[model samples]
Target: MKVIDLRSDTVTTPTEAMRKAMYDAEVGDDNAHEDPTVNHLEDLVCALLGKEAAILTASGTMSNLVAALAHTNRGDEVIMGSKAHMFWNEAGGVSTLGGVQVQLVPNDKGGRIDPADVEAAIRPDDVHAPRTSLVCLENTHNQCNGSVLTNEDMKAVADVAHAHGLPVHVDGARIFNAAVALEMPAHELCKDVDDVGFCLSKGLSAPVGSMLCGSADFIEEARRWRKIVGGSMRQAGVIAAAGVVAVETMIDRMVEDHAHARRLAEGLSHIPGINVDPDDFQTNIVFVGVDPNTGSTEEFTDRMKEEGVLTAYRGGGRFRLVTHREVGAEDIDTAVDRIAKVASEMRNAR
Candidate 1:
C-alpha cells in the first residue's frame, strides 16, 4: 500500500540541495549576529520582501509573536481578521504574554478585510480603551481556502490603518503562493504593509525557519522581542542554509502546487458527500466539508487514514488537504480516487 500525505505544506521534505547546503554551510554564533549564512539568508529575505531588514525566527508562530510584541505595547490592540493564522491558530501569545488585545474583524471570502471595519475597530483618544497600534493581514488567508488579498484591497485597508497611525503587519506564510497566483512579485504584495513574516518551511520546503521583515527600526524592536521569546540563536545558519536554498530555488516551483490544488478541488467537487467551491480556491490549501448526515469529519478523516491519505480536520466538519513540493499531480489523482471511494462508502452507509 502507498501512502499520500496531503495534510499541509508543512509535511514537505527538504530538497537535496537544501540538505547539502545544511551540511556544507558556514557556521558562527547567530545570537551575536555573526553567522555568515544566516546573515546572507536575512539579506535575501529583506530584499525579497523589500524591507529594510529581516530577522530569522524558528517558526511562523514565533515570527508573529515577535511582530506583535514589537509593534504594540502592553494593553494595546492588534486589529486583524478573525480567520488570521495569528489570531486563530496561535495560542493567544500576544494577549497572554504581552497583554495585547486581539481585535478580530470579519474577513471577506477573498481574504480582504473591509477598510470600514478596520476604521471602526480603532479606539478613540480615551484613557480606558486599548489603543489600536497594529493591523495584521494574511496573504492567501489560510482559512479562506487560500484566497489572495489583492494589492488594491491591501492598500485600501493599509490606508485606513495609516490614517489612524497604526502599523500594518502581514502574516505572509503563504505569500509566495499569492504572488505566483497573481503573476506578481512577492515584494509587490508586501509593499503596502509596514511589516511581513513569510515562512520558509511551508511551500518553500525548508526544514525550519521563517523571516520577520520590516523597516530597520521595526526590526530592531522585533529583535528585542525575539530575545524575550528566546528565539535568539547561535550558529542557526546550519538550518538557515536550507532556508537560503528554499528562497533561491523553491519559490518558482510553487505554481505546480497551486495547479495540483486546483485539480484536487475540482475532483473533490465530483464526490457526493464533500462540499467545496472551486471559484473560492486560489492557492495550495483546499477545504472540503463532509455532509453531517453522511459522516463526521473524524469518521471521514480516520477512514482516509486507513486508505493511506491524511489531512487536518477542524470545526464545521471541514478538512484541509494542502499540495506542496512533495505532493504532485499523480498524488492528486491518487488522492482523488481514495477520497471518492471514502465519500461513496459513507454516502451508501447513510
Candidate 2:
C-alpha cells in the first residue's frame, strides 16, 4: 500500500537540484556574516519581500522569537490574532524567553483581526499597563484553514499599529502561498508591515531554514537576538543553498498545490460523514470536520492511517490536510477514496 501523507508541507523533501546546489555551495562562518551562500539567500529574501535586509534562522519559530526579541522590551505586550501561529504553535517562546506578553484579539473565520479590535487592544501610556510595543499577524494563517490575508487586510492593521507607535511583524511562514493565491507579489502582500518572517522549508520545499526581513537596523538587532536564542550558525551555506533554489525555482509552482488542496476539499465534501467547504479552500491547507455521529477525530484519523492515508488530527473534531510538491492529483483522488471508505465504514459501524 502507498502511504499518502497529508500531514503538512514540512514533510516535503529537498529536490535533486537543491541537493546538487548544497553540494556545490560556498561556505564560511555565517555568524561573522561571511557565508557567501547564506548571504545570497538573505539577499534573495530581502528582494522578494522588499525589505532592506534579512537574516536566516533555523526555523519559523526561531524567526518569530527573534522578531519578538528585537521589537519589544521585557514586560512589553504584543498584539496578534487569537489564532496566530506564534500564540498557538510556537511553544510560548516569546513570553518565556523575551518576557513579552501576548495580547490576543479575536480572529474572524478568515483569519483577520479587525482593525478596530487592534485599536481597542492597544494599551494606554500608563504606569500600570504593559506597553503595547508590537503587532503580529500570520499570512495564510495556519489555524484558519490556511486563510490568506490580503494586502489591504495587512495595511489596515499596520496603519493602526503604526499610529500607536508600534512595529508590525508578519509570521509569513507561507507568504508565498498567499502571494500565489492572490495573484500578487509576496513583497506587495507585505509592503505595509515593518518586519516579516517566511519559511523556506514549508511549501517552498527547502530542507531547512526561514528568513526574517526588515530594515538593516532592525536586522542588526535581530541578529543579536538570534545569537541570544542560540540560532547563530556556522558554515550554514550548505543548507542555505537549497533555500536559494527554493526561492528561485519553487515559488511559482505552488499553484499546483493550491489546486490539489481544492480538489481534496471538494472530494472530501462528498463523503457523507465528512464536512468541508470547498469555497474556503483558499491555499494549500484543507481543514476537514468529522461528523460526531460517525466518530471522534481521533478514531477517524486512526482509521485513515490504517487505510494508508495519513492526516493530522487537530483536536476538536477537525483534521488538517496540507498539499505540497509530493502530493499529486492522483494522490488526492486516492486519499479521498481511502477517506471515503473509512468514513463509510465508521458510519456503518455506528
Candidate 3:
C-alpha cells in the first residue's frame, strides 16, 4: 500500500541536495558563535528578512520563545491571535518562563486579528496592568487552513502596535509559503514588523532549525535567552548547512506543495460529508469539516489512515491535510480518492 503522509509539512524529508549540503558542512562550536555554517545561515536569514541580525535556533518553538523573551521583560504583556500556535500549541513557555501575560484577541476566519482589536488590547501605563511590550502574528496560520496575510494586512496590525510603542513579532514559520501565494517577497511580508522568526524545517525541506531576525541589539539579547533556555547548540553547522541550501533552492518549489493542497481540497469538497472551500486552500494546508451526518471525525480519520492517507484531525470536526516535498499532486489525488471511497462505504454501512 502507498502511504501519503499529509499530517503536516513537518513530515517532509530533506531533499538529496539538502543532504549533500549537510554532509559537506563545516561544523564548530555554535554555542560560542564560532560555527561558520551557522553564521552563514544567520546571515542568510538577516538578508532574506531585511533585518540587521539573526540567530539560529533548534526549532520554531525555541525561536518564538527566544523572540518573546528578548522582546519582553518579566511581568510584561503580549498581544496575539487567539488561534495562533503560540497560544494553543506551544507549551505556554512565554508565560511560564518569562512571566509575560498573553492578551489574546479573537482571530477572524481569515486567521487575522483586526488592528482595532489589537489597539484596544494595548494596556495603559498606569502601573496597574502588565505593560504591553509585544504583538505577535503568524503567517500561513496553521489553525486556519494556512491563510496568507497580505503585506498590507500585516502593516495594519504593525501600525497599531507601533503607535503604542509595542514591538511587532511575526511568527512566520511558513513565511516563504505565504510569500509565494501572495506573489511578494518574503522579506516584504515581515519588513514592517519589529522582529520575525521563520522555520527552515517545514516547506523548505530542511532537517532542522529556525531563525529569529531583528535589529542587532535585539539579537544580542535573544542570544542570552537562547543560552538560558539551553537552546545554545554546539557544532550545529551541519544542520545550518541544510538550512542555507533550503533558502537557496527550496522556496520556489513550495508552489508545487500549494498546488497539491489545492488538489486535495478540491477532491474533499466534492465528497458529501467533507465541507471544504477549495478556493481558500492557500499554501500547503487543506482544512475540511467532517459532517457527523456521515461519520464521526475520529472514524473518518481512522479510515483514511487505514487506507494510507495519513493526516491530522483538528478539533471541531475539522481535519488538516498538509502537502510537502515528500508528497506530490498525484499523492493528493490518490488520498482524496481513497478517502472518498472509504467515507462512502462507511456511510453506506452505517
Candidate 4:
C-alpha cells in the first residue's frame, strides 16, 4: 500500500537541483559573516520581502524567537492572535528564553485579529503594566486552515501597533503561499510590517533554514539574539545553497499544492462523517472535522493511518492535512478515498 503523508509541508525534501547546488556551494564561516552562499540567500530574502537585511536561522521557531528577543526587552509584552503559531506551536520559547509576555487577542475564523482589539490590548505607560513592545501576525495562518491574511488586513493591525509605538513582526512562514494565493508579490504583502521571517523548508522544499528580515540595524541585533539562542552556524553554506535554489525555483510551484489542498477539502466534504468548508482553506493546509456521532478525531486519524494515510489530529475533533511538492493531485484523491472509507467504517461500527 502506498502511504499518502498529509501531515505537513515540513516533511518535503530538497530537490535534485538543491542537492547539486549544495555539492557545488562555496563555504565560509557564517558566524563571522563570511559564508557567501548564506549571504546570498539572505540577500535574496531581503529583496523578496522588501526589507533592508535578513539573517538565516535553523528553523521558523528560531526565527520567531530571535525576532522576539531583538524587538522586546525583558518583562515586555508582545501581542499576537490566539491562533498564532507563535502562541500555540512554538513551545513558549519567547516567554521562557526572551523573558517576554504574550498577550492574546482573539483571531476570527479567517485568522484575522481586529485592529480595534489590538488598539485596546496595548498597555498604558505605567509602572505596573508590562510595556507592549511588539505586535506579531502570521501570514497563511497555520492553525486557521492556512487562511491567508490580505495586505489590507495586515496594514490595519500594523497601523494600530505603530500608533502605540510598537514594532510589528510577522511570522510569515508561508508568506509566499499567501502571495501566490493573492496574486501579489510577497514584498507587497509584507510592505507595512517592521520585520518578517519566512521558512525555506516549508512548502519552499529546502532541506533546512528560515530567513528573518528587517532593517539593517534590527537584523544586526537579531544576529546577537540568534547566537544567544545557540543558532549561530559555521560552514552553513552547504545547506544554505539549497535555500538559494528553494527561493529561486520552488515558489511558483506552490500553486499546485494549493490546488491539491482544495481538492482534498472538496473530496473529503463528500464523505458521510467529515465536515470541511472548501472555501475556508486558502493555502496548502486543510482542516477536517469529524462528526462526533461517527468517531473522535483520534479514532478517525488512527483509522486513516491504518488505511495508509497520515494526518495530524488536532484537538477538538479536527485534523490538519497539508499538501506539499511530494503530494500530487492523484495522491489527494487517494487520501480522500482512504479517509472516506475510514469515516464510513466508523459510522457503520457506530
For residues 10-129, write the lDDT of model 2, one tens digit per residue. 999999999999999999999999999999999888999999999999999999999999999999999999998899888999999999899999999999999999999999989999
True-structure RMSD for candidate 3: 1.0
Per-residue lDDT of 3-48 in model 1, one digit per residue for the tens?
9999889988898999999999998998888999999999999888
lDDT of 4: 0.94
TM-score of each: 0.98, 0.99, 0.98, 0.99
Q: Which candidate number would show the highest lDDT if scored against the true structure? A: 2
Better candidate by TM-score, 2 or 3: 2
lDDT (tens digit, per residue) of candidate 3 on 152-216: 88999999988888899989999999999998887887888888889999989898999899999
Residue 327 of model 3 has an lDDT of: 86
Model 3 CA lDDT for position 222: 97
Model 1 TM-score (2 dp): 0.98
TM-score of 3: 0.98
Per-residue error (Å), model 2, residue 104: 0.4
Candidate 4 segments whose C-alpha is farther than 4 A from its true place: none
What are the per-residue Cα lDDT tens digits for candidate 4 across 250-313? 9999999999999999998888888998999999999998899998999889888999999874
Full ranking by lDDT: 2, 4, 1, 3
